[model samples]
Target: MEAGEPTSLQIEKQSLHDQVASRIRDLIIEGHLEPGSRIDEAKLVEQLGVSRTPFREALRTLAAEGLIVIRPARGSMVRKLSRADVFSMLEVLAEMERLAGRTACERASDSEIAHARDLHERMLEYYRSGERMPYYKLNQEFHTFIASLSRNETLCEIQGNIMARLKRIRFIGNSEPEHWRAAVDDHEEMMDALAARDGQRLGDIMAHHLSETWQRVKNVI
Candidate 1:
C-alpha cells in the first residue's frame, strides 16, 4: 500500500525466479549439468518444483550470461567453451584488465587501494589454506575491485560480463598448484604497480598476467 514499494505478490514472484536461476547457475558451476549437454527442461522443472514459466526464465537468464545456449529446435544446454572461444574471451578480458590497471593507477583513491590490499591478504590466507573455492571467489573480487577503481562504467560492465562467462574455466585454471601460485604472484605485482601509480607498468603486467593465465587454462581445458 505504498508508492514505489512492490506488492507482496510481486516480491514473491521475484524471489521465486531469483532462487530458480541461482540454483541452475550453481548446478552448472558444480558441473552437475555438463557442458555441451542439453538441459532437460521437463526434468528440471519437475525437480525444481516449478512450472514451465519460471524454469524457462531461469534458462534464458543463464543463456544471456553465456552459461547456456537456447537453440530453436534443440532447446537449452550448457555452453561448451572451445579453445578458440576461451582465447577470444581472454583476449578481450586482457585488454579490459589492462585498461583497468592503467586507469586505476591514475585514479584510484587511497581508500580503494587499501580495500584491494585487504582483499589480497585474505586471498593469500585462502591460498595458504588450500581452499580453492574461497580463494577463487576472492580472486574474482580482487579483479572486480580493480575494474571498479578504473572509474569507467563501460569497461567495468564489459569486463564483468566476460569474467562471468569465464568463471567456470578460470576456476579450473586454479586446479594446478604452480598455476595458482603464479597467479598470486601476479596479483602481488599488480598491487605494487597500483600503489606506485605506474599506469603503463600496471597495464603491461595485467596483460601478461591474463595471457599466462589463459595458457594454464588452455593446457587444462
Candidate 2:
C-alpha cells in the first residue's frame, strides 16, 4: 500500500458522512430545518436515503460547527443562536474578515487579486440579471477567495465555521433588495482596495461591511 493512502472502507465512510453533512447543511441554511427544532433522525434518514451511521456522524460534525446541539435524552436539535450570540459571532467574523483583508492586501499575489476581480465581475453579472441565488452564492465565493488570499489555513477554517453558522441569516439579508444592493456596493469597494494593495483601507471597509450586514440581519435574529 502507498504511504498516507486511505483504505477503501475509510474512503467510503468519509464520502457517506460528507454527503450526509452537505445535505443537512443545505437544509439548515435554507431554513427547511428550522432553528431550535429537533432533528427527526428516522425521517431524515428515510428521506435522504442514507443509513443511521452516516447520519449520526453528520450530526456530530454539525454540532462541532455550532449548527446543531446534542443534549442528553433530548437528542439533537438545530442550534438557535440568540441575538446576543449572533452579535458575538458576527463580531468575531468581522475581525476575522478584517484580518483577512489586511493580510491579503499585504501578501496576496497579483494573480490572486486579479482572480478576485474576475469573481466580482461574475457576481455583478448575476446581480444585473436579477439572479438572487446565484449572486448570493458567488458573493460568498468572492469572500472565501479573499480569505484564501490571506494564505492562512487556520484563519480560513475559522472563517468557514463562523460563516456556516450565520449562513441562514446571511441568506435572508441577501434576499432583501436594499441590503443586497448595499452588499454589492461593498464588494465593489473591497475590490478597489485590493487592487490598490491598501491593507488598512481594505480592513476598515471590511469592518464597516460586516457592521452593515449585522444591521441587515438584526430583524431576522
TM-score of 1: 0.83
C-alpha local distance difference test of each model: 0.84, 0.84
What tens-digit string does per-residue lDDT give for candidate 2 at 1-221? 12432222122334478888877876787677889989988877766777889889999999888899989888899999898988888899999999999999998999988999999999999999998767877878888889999999999999998887887777778777888898888889999999999999898898888888788888787
The residue-level lDDT of candidate 1 at 189 comes to: 90
Clash count, predicted structure 1 = 0
Q: Return the TM-score for each candidate structure.
A: 0.83, 0.84
lDDT of 2 at 161: 87
**Model 2, stretches more than 4 Å misplaced?**
1-15, 129-133
lDDT of 1 by residue, 6-47 (tens): 222122344377778877776676567778888988767766
Candidate 2 has its poorest 10 consecutive residues by lDDT at: 1-10
TM-score, cand. 2: 0.84
Clashing pairs in 2: none
Error of 1 at 190 (Å): 1.6
